[model samples]
Target chain A: MSDNISSSRLTDIDGWGRSESLRSIARRSFQFFYDNYFRVEWEGLEKIPDDGGALLVSNHAGAIPMDAPIIMHGVEQHLGRPVYGLADHFFRQIPVVGTMWSRLGGVPAHPDNAYRLLRDEHQLALVFPEGTKGTSKVFTQRYRLRRFGRGGFVEIAMKAGVPVIPIAVVGSEETMPILFKINSLAKATGLPYFPITANWLMFGPILGTAISLPAKFKLRVLDPVHFNVPPDQDRYSKSRIMDESESIRLTIQENLYDMLAHRGNPWLG
Target chain B: MGRRVLLTGLGTFWGGKVAQSLEKHPDVDVIVGMDVTEPIVELERTEYVRADETYSILSRIVDATQVDTIVHTFLVVDSTQMKTKRLHEINVIGTMNLLAAAGCAGTPVRRVVVKSSGMVYGCTGRDPLWFLEETPRTDPPETTIEDSLVSAEGYLRDFAQDNPHVSVTLLRFSNVLGNDISTPFTETLSRGIAPSIFGFDPQLQFIDEDDVVSAIEFATSANVPGIYNVAGDGLIPWSEVAKICGASNLPLPPFGTEAAASILRKMGLVKFPPEILQLLRFGRGIDNSRFKDLGFSYKYSSLGAVERFAKTKRLSKAIGIPRSPYTYDKDVESFFHHSPSVVRSTQSDSTSDTF
Candidate 1:
């Protein structure tokens, strides 16, 4: 209870390596993109429970994947609840972006990290099971979902005893459409995939990789996928897990087509 | 009869500190401490005996003394203290020999408490936020020290399975920060600049040095079996740790960090070993709840330990540590411990609680 107990701490970083002060600073920048640039719209946001933990599974695209920030910012703004965006551990391999990402609630997409966040801490966790494969799609293959990584995310939700909430986002594909990818370059660099985005062609070397186009975003939250089976099992049925995983994928794919069909313009709602 | 204890690594920080505290315990009847060198700390009742670093004649000593408890506190966790071969000899071979001596056909040792480091859970990108007692390492051991500890723990696991009658307590202590003990971290913080992986601020867990002694004592005295993680509560970022120590973060290039750290080490500017280097990139944390469930408590949290270390460093800066406050004299110590003519008094230490 002494003043020196926690007074010596220079930053407000938590055990998860997330810092509220830093998150707020990052939020200010993200708020601009969420409001003006993307103009993201959401439907059935209340389906994301007011309390308890739930896993958010969404479609992933864009050279930079702007859907993560758009969804996280919208949830945080409306519900005032922090949403932990789980991505590939590759993000942690980078230097400054790694630390900045962690401070801004970007957790490495480890199943253990996800379970701890959802079951133990009871916080909303967002995951794009498509991983890099989803983001690797070119402009021609836009809106087409990829295989959710062996249904590992479903297994984690089953183990953590949380509902899997499928989220369908339209317009993320156009944010920074991948014109094509250079596999040899990706192999040379040790990255999963190297994409040449349309943004890069327009904005040149620097701003190309950083900027996302003005794409009107529409996100729909589907009904929660509850396994209803008990939690914390050592192993769940693999067949059942894949079935649930593929079902969720189909639902999101269906929702994307519906949302896109309703929108008259790609840049206007 | 009261408990007879044999403590290894008497000259080391943990061995000496624990021996000092154990000497005051009413239940402890015999204290036989063995090490490669003379104990730096003065002791009232601990009988010192010189042994090889690998403790070659450990079985003979255990058989002759018939000590009921063996406290293995000498395993080296610090990589910079010595060469790799020496580290392997002390950590793996020394532990294997000690366990062999304690668990031989008809040994008197009933309880064995081994002081392990949290480094056994190697830090990696795939590691969980909080590792439970049963959580397996995300990656295999990358450094010699980590490999040696993992191997020693493997032997310990086998020992526990073979000897059900004997209690085995493995206390995996987090990176320690306190007065006196010199680890790679302590050395870094004592210097003016604490080099960090550029753009990487890993969350690190710490245990106070005094709490390290207490945790070992708790495991030694209690019948708590199985492995337990002993760390101060919570984790703090490396940046915050440097700030607490009043040291600036000298960012080492994250891309070529190992090369940069080696260059710094060559210049004698820092001592960031491969293990510490990986730790700087990705920190490790272990859940300490299982140990707390055993009714043990830590006096300081991670923040408290850092704050205390900073204060102690400041004081030591103002006035350097007293040079050789106590030196071991073999003749006098032998006489006081063995000479029947010298009148002895009951060691009802009034200040035992302070330690």
Candidate 2:
């Protein structure tokens, strides 16, 4: 296996490069995308620290994964710190897409991978602790945070002892409204679940192209909540670790759910 | 003959220190320490009376003891019991009782020194202005139960005017700090902790314990019947104070008054006797030019008292010097060291999970 493909190894991105002109270019590019393509609105940016290693956990929305990118761009523009996403395995399989993902500092989604990255490197790790269940949830279960399975992110954080920052992204699901889910097709394809959205059936067959509606995205970063894990728990059993992790995961998820409910509409003034 | 002086609220941290100082005074004939607690000190004239500082109990104590000269040092720092009824009971009614008893018994009470906080200025909303003795008390909206302090000053002023024989001296003190046996600011400072500061720019003045006692003594001897600002010489910013004390200066975001309330709630440090919070947040500096004219001198006149007292007590172990408390967390330290590498791996892992 190539050194680049090593499980524990990480390829550094030039996101935090100090080339002033390049930085300005990146800023202008982000601004252009924000102004023309999608109008981005952010709230509670002050809660995210200017410089710190934080764990950003958000409820996954939009089957196409628009929430994560919007959050990353929002945080990056506001705090001037490059946000790195913890991506799943399929993205790395695609040729051109995989290389772009590597450059963007996309790590593997395994628990061991998260633990290694968080412990070895101090960069911000953005995760959807709700997993596929949240992203694949039907439109009927709108805005409700799914059961975050025994939060591995929380356990990794507890072991790493970093602050967990709960974030909420609005308007992503509205961009591509999911109509229903085909369980048999999802099972046959070995995917988490297939989302049958308004665009999914009409865009490909009738229009011969996929087009997502332009929705105003609002991203909010909540105050960093630090976990005080006991030092003696280093030698504790896996069950204890899992229990502790799940507690933190649920707390962050609940807070995100509440914040989304309170925020009302991201697009409205 | 040493003059007989009645010191109320002698059980409190500040009151106890004053009681100790009065006991050491060569000319103080008797230091009748009146407190709700059992008497611990056994000095010849240092007696502790087990009575509450209420209208009835104080009247009885004054009558029984024939206490003519009263040093009104009694104060409650507990915010919970700073209600109107409670404040009136202790501050207004209690002072009335002592004055009435002094009048009935014909004890020839010449001077009554009342210790008040400079917090009566209501330091919020107003532009930065030096407060003089004549600054009118402005009522602040929504304060802790101890906020009745602004009204108490009016009572003191009125009483001083009414009583021809008895002279009332009001010493408006800044934040009082020193070797307080009970509520020691030094102890908290030594432990590398600070009472959560609500705002970014916290301008504060502090009077030392010794200075407070000296001021009271000055008031007693001198024929002054007006308000005086009894604070230290210099002012210090809250950020600098945190640095000197070796604690983290956490800036509370400007959430307006709600944020301030939240901080006080979270920290659980908002304990001041009834009517003190209004004066605390609103009231400004009490002009001490009058007291200075009467030849009063202070030993420690800066909020740097924490550093000075800490050095004296050899409390280096409590406050971590050279090394900060942030280094205590290994994960935090590791994160700082390898932040870039960690971000990359986490991102890749997340991407791989999607496929």
Candidate 3:
């Protein structure tokens, strides 16, 4: 594009998701942690298509849900295209995090917004179907996948006619390994659960168990599953969509198990 | 077919302008202007009739003139001119009176074009990015002005349904900004320090003043009959708009804005209503494709309209510093080049320099 045309197009952007200036700043800030702290070793970088829309379905973990950002950063670093993550409605209710998430290209996981991102903008979208259930699991249940919510992601991908790329990250489950969930305290604090973890209990208040263990992250991008149907086809009924969603869930779960068996230690990738 | 038009709200700028334009139109044979106040502008052929909305004179004028089109441009946008309650009366009650008079049995009015506002789509935390023409009206509107507009729309919907013969075109215009027009939105922008809710930059849409007139003209002339969202081409964030207007921002927390609103109201700087605050926090944008499809296009985009409005001498006082001729990005680029470090390097070795 000519410089004049590109500059005019830049001005036309209404600062919705992915503000060029703010995204660059946020990318630099997050890159520090991704490179130094977790030291993420990502595989299947070539699985992502160069252009058009794609959906990344990953398992949710870590009490704070850092997997999405890690995946977002990894894809952006490798593919030169920013990935918009679908945050739960709860994120939008919070004061600062909600606004920050929006500015950082995290759209609330509403059907309207999802459709807009996937179909209208033709941008990659990341969704964690396991939700809080997968994140707040106890230590015994770590690496064991939770039930994917109603397969909304499948319906969305079907409607938008985008390929579903299942992603499996091995290390996030060890970040803030919860011993047990205290539902009573969780109710009082308005959080999903109050997790009692080793580092959190050991380290006292303020800097307590909130600190995530420096676990080496190993992320694998699985093969892209295309429906091979018409973009506007309604043949993929609700049940069919649910079944496809379950199959995608199973694919991620099997990959998690395979990754855990092959890995020597969780701390060392 | 030629039109015998009855133009309401002749005293206001839009009313006078519409009446003056209609007077010159070859298709329009008779122009009857109705308002309690006289027209502000000079007109040769237009007939000015003085009457309150509640009086029977409106119905009598409709019956006597046999006007086929009634252009209702009487919506009150600025609350500074009249008390809120009186503005409500002029807006809601006045609309009711005119609709009742025009839609009466055996009335000669076959078409009605009422200028509603986009404020009916309330600016809230849960608003869609762009409201379409078919978007449901905001129930129990966020502000008193919105409530009046909603009520007027409800009445229009009912009238359209009841009187199938009459074509009622509801023009839901975005916040209008023009050289001559002075609304609360314009005043807010022209303030010394425009206050916005901190950390929230809502996307706002605007319509040029001339475009509003042209839209009115289109509605009055064309056979299009439906609710339409009338706005300019693009949307701009309120912060970017503030930058364009050369006005500094005074960011206040959501809870703290109320006190600042009181101060603004006390100083007569703004009509700082809750809706305005909400609008500042979550600005409104609407889709105007349907209006374009109706064969009318806007002359200016939202930012262009605001830029034109900002150039007026009346707003120049509030805009103490004139907007830079260069774009914001260009200014940023020059700022780095002119900085001490870059300036020293470029001044010393001008050959291989990339700042």
lDDT of 1 at A94: 82
lDDT of 3 by residue, B1-355 (tens): 6689999888788998887667556677778888888667655456778888554578888888899999999888655667779888888888888889888989888999999888888765555567777766444675678788888888899889989999999999998887567777676676645677776666788888999999998899898899999998877877777776667887767666778777868977656577677777667678898889868877888877877765663445646555423322434434553555553432223223221
Using TM-score as the yardstick, the better of models 1 and 2 is 1
Candidate 3's C-alpha runs over 4 A off are A1-13, A89-98, A130-151, A178-211, A225-237, B54-56, B78-81, B137-140, B313-355
Best by DockQ: 1
Clashing residue pairs, candidate 1?
A: none
Cα miss at B32, model 2 (Å)?
1.9
Q: Note each model's CA RMSD in angstroms.
A: 2.0, 26.0, 13.4
Per-residue lDDT of model 1, residues B1-355, tens digit only: 7789999999998899999888778788899999998998888788999999888899999999999999999989999999999999999999999998899989998999999999998888888877887889978898999999999999999999999999999989999998789899998889867888888889899989999999988888889989999999999998888888899888888787888889889999987798988889988888899999999988998888999998878878888877558788999999988899877666565226533
Candidate 2: tens digits of C-alpha lDDT, residues B1-355? 6577888776655566566566555566666777765433323235666676663666666656665578878754334544657765676566666556555545556678888776566554331224567765444634432354555566666666767778888888776665433343444454555543243333356676678887877787667887788887655544455565565543333334445645554676433322332222222344466678878877765544544554434444545344212212335534643477644323223223221
Docking quality of model 2: it rates as incorrect
Top candidate (lDDT): 1
Model 3: how far is B301 from its true place, Å? 1.8
Complex DockQ per candidate: 0.67, 0.01, 0.10
